[model samples]
Target: MIRKDRAVVWGRFVRTRSGLRHHHPMTRKIEEAQPTWFRLSEESWNEIREAYRNGATAKELAVRWKVSPSSIYRHAWEGGWSKKRSADADARAHAEAIAEEERADQTRPDPEAGLFGPPGADDEAMLGDPAALAEQAMAASVRAMRARLFVEAEKLARLSEAYGRMAEKRGGPAVTIETIDLETLYDIVMNKDGRVGERFRVDPDDPGPRDPILVRYWSHRYAEREAFKEQIRRVRANARKAACRAVGLDPDAPLPGF
Candidate 1:
């Protein structure tokens, strides 16, 4: 049993009905009673420690627990609590964000993408597969060759148009001189009165021909057209070879019986 108005220095003194008496649970004398206002229970201290550990500030804890911020501060100081800098935390978060951005970059589309092509552009994945890469390489090479061919064809058309304009001015008929893509087209055809000194192969395989068309319709321009045949042959070599082989015609032996 306990009595009221008893000073409890660990409950060491009490005033009875007869007189004041001395008592100690452990026989130790305490001069002053523990101040109840400043003291806290083990359960309450445990809660405070937990709240501080889990990111509670002194002001936050003070308001929640109905205590002074000073008290909360004192408790935290004794418990050795500290809050990490907000900047440091933000930096770490941004570092993770940058890492994620790099991972996405692995598949990000390049604006200047070409040469081979973009991944999955046409039944070809541009990653980690040798056979698909080889096929795309071949396709890119073919595209380049065809592009050059188209450019050459456009140039040839321009030259032919120039010949047509020249013939209209001279009142002469359109001739085979317009068939060439030569830079010398204008120079050759400007003098049509000269003899046509041009010669060509009767057969690609034989390389034997001494015939000349020494007429008004043939000249250096005609010779140029004959020479241009060799250029055309080179340009169509691959396709012609493929076609010849497909039809059982020897590509190196020229057209048979010609």
Candidate 2:
């Protein structure tokens, strides 16, 4: 039996009257009075130790277990729990993130398929011949570029025509310039005429001798289009040379089946 003010600490009751005392076994000190805080059961204390070792913070465990954070820290120190649990948690999280990124990469779409379109049965058949594979890749790349150029050129023409109509309403020239069709522009650019200069020429400062704003707009876009085409050309050339070198062939020599 115990009084209201008297309580048990470690199964030893506090004194109900003066001059009666209890002592701690390890500390070997006479107990002054029952502490204000409550004690956790052995099972709960064991769980707290395990949680602390596995990266749970003392304050977090204290809140969850309804104990003082100081008690949690004291118990951890007594139990020899590692203080480097936070660092271990961070390392674990970093490893998981890297694994997740690798998993995402495995499921990601291929850029080559997106750009040059999916390979056909014939392209699959050319896998054994590196030079043939390189040629096929280049051909696919050129076809894709041509298709994109046609679409963009048509869009530019429509924009130019719309601008012309708007100009007419403002009492200006009805059309700023003649809108060239995609085929005519392709021929003019590909033929390398003096007016065009080169196949992949990109001179921003000089939109050429053409006076029309249409030519200037086309010139700007053409430079961008040619830049992409040149990149493809360079990539193909390099890939072909690499393929040749891999087979112990002369890289500077003419490519096979050229």
> TM-score winner among the candidates?
2
Q: Cα lDDT for residue 216, model 1?
A: 36
Writing each residue's lDDT as its tens digit, candidate 2 over 61-93 gives 755666667787787787777758556776888
lDDT of 1: 0.58
Output the TM-score of candidate 1. Answer: 0.19
Give each model a TM-score.
0.19, 0.26
Winning candidate number (lDDT): 2
For candidate 2, give the lDDT: 0.64
Residue 16 lDDT in candidate 2? 40
lDDT of 1 by residue, 78-197 (tens): 776555544466578889999999989988975324434545655544444444444555565555456565554444444444444544545644445667556457545554434222
List the global CA lDDT of all models. Answer: 0.58, 0.64
lDDT of 1 at 201: 21
